[model samples]
Target: MTSSLQRAAFAGTYDDESLCGSGLMVVRAEAEAVAALAGRIDAYFAAACKLILACNGRVVVTGMGKSGHIGGKIAATLASTGTPAFFVHPGEASHGDFGMITAQDVVLALSNSGETPEILAILHLIKRLDVPLISMTGNPKSTLARQSQVHIDTSVREEACPLGLAPTSSTTATLAMGDALSVALLEARGFTREDFAFAHPGGSLGRRLLTRIQDIMHTGPEIPSVPETALVRDAVLEMTAKKLGMTAVVDGRYRVLGIFTDGDLRRLFEKAGDIHTTPINEVMTRFCTRVSPELLAAESVRIMEEKRISALLVVDDDNRLIGALNMHDLLRAGVV
Candidate 1:
């Protein structure tokens, strides 16, 4: 019971094959453009990395229009990956922003045609300051390319745009070139995960790599623990009071002997045992998973997931209970 208008509204589109073909064509074109850059990583690319590595001041990246957007991202990637870099709009460079650049700084300029007016306008200033210039462009003979100390060829065979007007494949080629530079610098500087974590402290990768169990675990009286001689009722009371759904059964030295959880209660209920009179040690899970306070919170998450457990008892080298945490803590700390 479908109306003709409803069917037309839902299904009246261009041919599916044509739409899919267009998308595939664009993707293939961009892939080819990126692939073509592999062979162009010659001595000039290595020299560019050396210049940035030897630079004492920050890298100043500039471009016009769409190239500017790509330049900003490239600068961000470089700064986060160990190189100190920032973006400057080519138009703004003519203004007072040009003061941000110094003789020690390296300039990375991008333009598909290699003749953007704004970029060209600032070339004389860069020359006067004696700053190293690296140009990424499609035209090798363009003024910007010829003037640069290191010229990267980011030429694309054709535009992904069917009209051959919009900068689609050319922009992709430029972005890939930027990524290549950043990664080369990153490897050259021996950037580690710890350094990356410091740069991205607010990100999930930082939380996973930098956060330790001691940073987020519940310590002191917040831990729900009872002597192994305690009764099931006492254990249940401790679990309920702490709201951790579990309690660690420890010895007089505070060494973990077993663990009692809500799951134990469910299994106990199936038997005729008296809850109040039963010793927790007789019904508790003897083989319990334990973690150290120094362990990474991300490693704790992996252990919990693999063991199918929600809570873990934090123990010291002597296997004595020092702290405790649950899956909820990890989730709250953004480690999950």
Candidate 2:
């Protein structure tokens, strides 16, 4: 009963079950290839890391075709993770980009087939310059692997492509190997979070690590504060004026004695108390959360979250009020 148009529409269309099975097969094959690499991490890997660490200059990465695309990403990862590296196109190397590579540099080359002509063309130049060469390939006996000081086998049992021609599993294995190398070198170099923050100063992680409490706090007259002797109504006025949801109660020396918030006001209202005539000290919270100016804003966020508070008072070693801040400050500064 199906028309010709309906038959044509279903001819090449895959059922959901077939599509899901095909996708899972590709993922499993690639995962197995990456897992196999764990056993291949030996002394050669250590030597490669040592060579890169000892290099006086950069790590030069080179490859051809699809390998070249993966090489660029690997180079970027290495550079961002404490290793200085860059990608050089094998085709461009013969056209003068080779000058970017120096004897002080270590070359990391990629080629699925060990006989890539563009890469092999530069092997002689690399040797003449006395630069150490590291190769990643599927074929161990290929010319590229034989000429290198270290050979990382990125071989997959079979291509994930149904035709066994397009690169799928092989590229995944190579990229995972690159990540392993970058992370190993990152740890070996003792790279710290601060170093990472410096590299990514504009990112959210950088903001969290580098921003200090003093950098985003409200100081001077912007801080809502009142003398301990002030009335509860006066404290409320200050809080409303500053719109900070709370006010600090301080002694004659400007040392913080307690804090009063809108929540306390609501509790006082339930008791039908004369808040306008009541001393602020009587209703204020005596034990308050305070932080030093040098504390990281990110850590302050954790304190606020743990205590379920929205505002914090910044104080000095002697407990004298220096500044004030609330959740909004952290949010505006992108520290949250």
Candidate 3:
């Protein structure tokens, strides 16, 4: 049977006030459930984490129905952080997938009522393997909670569901507890940003931490360059040809002397100098900033922002120009 709120929604009798009131009720209920979890993070929670940390193999999380979905996300968060973990459906675990859990692994079982049939079905197998069992349940006195080596209390005062049949608040509490476990384990292991990058190599944070200037900088023939003796016109021609908005001024030995850019061209224009006659080195900015190929693209971003510059030149040990890059390059590489 639906609640009055549900009936009103179905009958199109709900106004904005009623709709918002019902939505707020759900939000408040879920919020209270999650808030209660803070106090529940007691000794039992620590014990669960200890079991996971001491495990030699992996964390095998299993649950039935809605709990299974939360288990999958929890497992993912655990695996991505520091602890290796994966989700297994309780129904599937009884069907030979139980072989996946060895004595070296720890099993984390989820069941709000603490008496899910599928979860209980795997208890004998889990016991046979002598694996550590950690359970999260709303009932501390329930069978699953009693059988587990460690039991975390995820009980909610009320479900957000109007009829109290849906998983609403229970699932949120379980997911929050899962996050707490994952992050606690992560901190205990002293997981670093570099370690996280290895797990998420394709993510923006990974790209920022792992990408070197050489990986995104214009290299070889793509580098815009001109000899110091080259006229302003020649430098402008090279810049336009390379489309980098600037050209490196180098000596005959290819060692960088300075840089000529669009800004310098504008200054030259104000002074009424003949672009074809004036040498680039005479009008270029001397002692221009340079970066090494091994520098991180993220570091280059800091340098650019601090110096209020839009472009940078990449140089080798001998100060020879090897590459060039602008802010646009960093943006394209997602370093920005």
Please list the C-alpha lDDT of all candidates, in the order they appear: 0.95, 0.94, 0.94
Model 1, 285-313: lDDT tens digits are 99999999999999999999999999999
RMSD of each: 4.9, 3.5, 2.6
For model 1, what is the alpha-carbon lDDT of residue 76? 98
Ranking by lDDT: 1, 2, 3
Q: Which rank order by TM-score, best down to worst?
A: 3, 2, 1
Candidate 3 lDDT by residue in tens digits, 1-336: 899988887886468998899999999999999998989888988999888888899999999999999999999999999799999999988788888888999999999999999999889999988999999999999999999999999999989999999999999999999999999999999999999988988999999999999999999999999987789999989999999889999989999999988999999999999998998878999979999999999999999999988999999999999999999999999989
Candidate 2 deviant stretches above 4 angstroms = 1-11
For this target, which candidate reaches the highest TM-score against the unseen true structure? 3
TM-score of 1: 0.88
Candidate closer to the true structure by lDDT (higher is better), 1 or 3: 1
lDDT of 1: 0.95
Instruction: State every prediction's TM-score relative to the real structure.
Output: 0.88, 0.89, 0.94
Q: How many residue pairs collide in each prediction?
A: 0, 0, 0
